[model samples]
Target: MQPYGDVDSTLRAIAGRAEGFGRHAIGGLHGALYLVTSLSDDGPGSLREGCRRQEPLWIVFEVSGTIHLSSYLSVSSNKTVDGRGQRVKLTGKGLRLKECENIIICNLEFEGGRGHDVDGIQIKPNSRNIWIDRCSLRDYDDGLIDITRQSTDITVSRCYFAQHDKTMLIGADPTHVGDRCIRVTIHHCFFDGTNQRQPRLRFGKVHLYNNYTRNWKVYAICASVEAQIYSQCNIYEAGDKKKAYEFYTEKAADKEEAKSGIIISEGDMLLNGAQPCLLTEYKESVFHPSEYYSTWTMEPATHSLREVIQLCTGWQSLCRPVDNMVMN
Candidate 1:
């Protein structure tokens, strides 16, 4: 409770504990700190071996380089991959967490992930109680982050997602009704110049709060397949195209009677764009503009989102500073 009272306190707590900040709900993650001393694919000091071990570990990097993973790095449960105090860039296949629990990934950079299933981080089915914080992801072949197959109780905060066509996907497929179990919290992230899907959800409950969005080529936040999204106190600055929010169904057309995908917006500020067109429950597939759902109302943000997000979002300065900070 010491850190949960305010924004500064919360950030300080997250920095002090790294990925261990949210470990209490899953019975607390206690592990050894495994230092990554090599950039090799596999060895004693390599990240591959560190994550491949069966026990819980806090994987910290000592060296700085780009690690091109030959295959997806399967991480076990109760693990924390902390990339602070080093410049660690991951390319190639990236990371995959399947059926794991109580995982933490923070302060890393992922780019140039190509080939099949080249996501920056893919959380597969039945994984729960995961935290991804303060990482930078871009230019992946598939998606920056994919949470699918009923992954739940996940928090993605203070991360930067940029320069990718497909950014984040919550549900695996439109017809995977099991995805209704997904519950994710995305807060204090920066979606900069992303094409679309930041993220596109399906059959899930996603809470997006206090994030910054700029120059989105396609629609910013999307909901499909009966996904319910609660967006609060976010800043959206659209460039020359697209609105801030959109609703669509995979199997149903815009004119169809299917009423899927719901968005509840509160205290959000949209700039350089028109008001978002909300969906209606009428015959022409258009919802009334003033339609309101009385589920919840977010309290006003205590601090300036633009000011606080700039310091918190993205990979904070490594041991040495990197010039990858993009400011709009």
Candidate 2:
């Protein structure tokens, strides 16, 4: 394992240079990083210290080995963690960020710690503008990802998950007033499963599109609330023989009322057993429905011109080295 001082100094130096250049976005109070050596060492300790300093911090694991957490890593708004790829891994029950906004977590591997309530990632209670990309979370007792209670403007893309109790869970806490739910987008992800989940969804607007699933699982997607959750071009290979999609709601209403619980906009999807099958979720629902026994395919591709331009213009510019190139 790399010594914590080496990593911490490098990050601090970057923050310092960014400050000297007057790039507030790259520095200022939001630029500090928190280095957590091991999950067993003291994660909340690092987080508490960062909070005390009142800076935007990044939590990194020094040990490349697996480190499990007793509870979730409670993150504040506008903070991010860069796993530096899979060099370091956090094996935990899960991560829970409550009432936080503008959180970005990328390039890490998560092993869901043991417990019924364990989930790979859980965003809760008015969290908004959260982005999770290019991560792998697996071996959990519950769903890999779960969102609840008025959390809005969240996106999870380009992630890999397998051997999960259930893949995705979206809904409202029901007990909380003034905490209803709204928009969430999930796309370009992979799920490998063969079992069904309980209480799939309760309330919210969700978009499930172009996701690839395997193992002939019990379900691909579902809903059970008041919203428009749609699935477009999703590929599934459910082990079952039924080609028809399943829509389950506690209350069966007329067409319009039925739409309130779990709504499906587009259901016809093709699958070919590939990876990262271009999924998209453009709407919302609690008890949404999904197709089964489908397959999809995916592979890494070189960048296109438009993609390169967008990448350069966005956050890429901030992380690029002084030499004007992204380091591998």
Candidate 3:
């Protein structure tokens, strides 16, 4: 059979087999499967079937144009979505996985959704061992990447986020909560919240490293009572001078509740002259220490403040400071 013919046949076979409940295995030679297009008229059975597989599977989408999904893409464990060339524009919720394990999403673009709480990607429940790599997301109301509840062992790398209300949001699932402590690794991502939406975050043992952010007066990074946050190598620049005050420290709790918990470490963070990035108590922990009650200059190594403001304000109105006071 011809190459296209074989691909078509394999996809059809997988789809037909996956529709049923019992375990089904389809085998093809190493080079037999190639160049599957999700935007084809048949509705992306090649990719979807790979997602439904119970065993290890590698599915590649050559995004010639855009692939729109009516609902969310629920990918289970042992599955991979690789956008070879195509830009997968998820007009709806994009990708949502609940209670799944060991799934991977890579090399895709997620457009904003119309729904109230639309997110680029959402991992929930006991879902663990997930990786989101080299993805671009924009214009979502809630956040670009969201990991919640007991979801653990997630690694997000080399992703670009901008033109959204909120770039990244992490939290514990309020329902069916667990104490396992979601451990996530975020590295080398770009966050720009130019639209001024609030950034929301509450996660356990999260590592935020080497990220560049802009204009996010609401929050460059936020941690809730449920989070043991660790951060380094991040750069955040404030948009408005007054809004910088909101971007600085733990807000919305009693003095004792806010202090003595979160561990925020060294980073090249930029702030407007009006807002200081340190609290009175945590001044000793700053990587580049600043004097108390003194105005400091922000370095240009950070991203543009306007873009970050849009991302923090336009994406999702979730993580805002409860009080307007800056401790320092």
Q: lDDT per residue, candidate 1, 29-64, as tens digits?
A: 355667899998888899989888878666778898
* True-vs-predicted CA distance for residue 224, candidate 2, Å: 1.2
TM-score of each: 0.82, 0.66, 0.66
- Candidate 1 segments whose C-alpha is farther than 4 A from its true place: 1-28, 251-258, 277-304, 318-328
Best by lDDT: 1
For model 2, the superposed segments whose C-alpha errors exceed 4 Å read 1-29, 43-54, 60-62, 173-180, 197-199, 241-244, 251-260, 265-268, 271-328
| lDDT per residue (tens digit) for residues 1-328 in model 2 | 1001222234333221110001122222255445555445353645334423345665544445665667666666656665552354556566786887656665677775677777778878777767675577777777677777777666665566667656667764444433334566565556655354312555555655545554545555555544345555455554552322344554323233433344453543433432222223433323342231122222222223213222321111123112222223
Q: Assess each prediction's global lDDT (C-alpha) against the native.
A: 0.74, 0.50, 0.51
TM-score of 3: 0.66
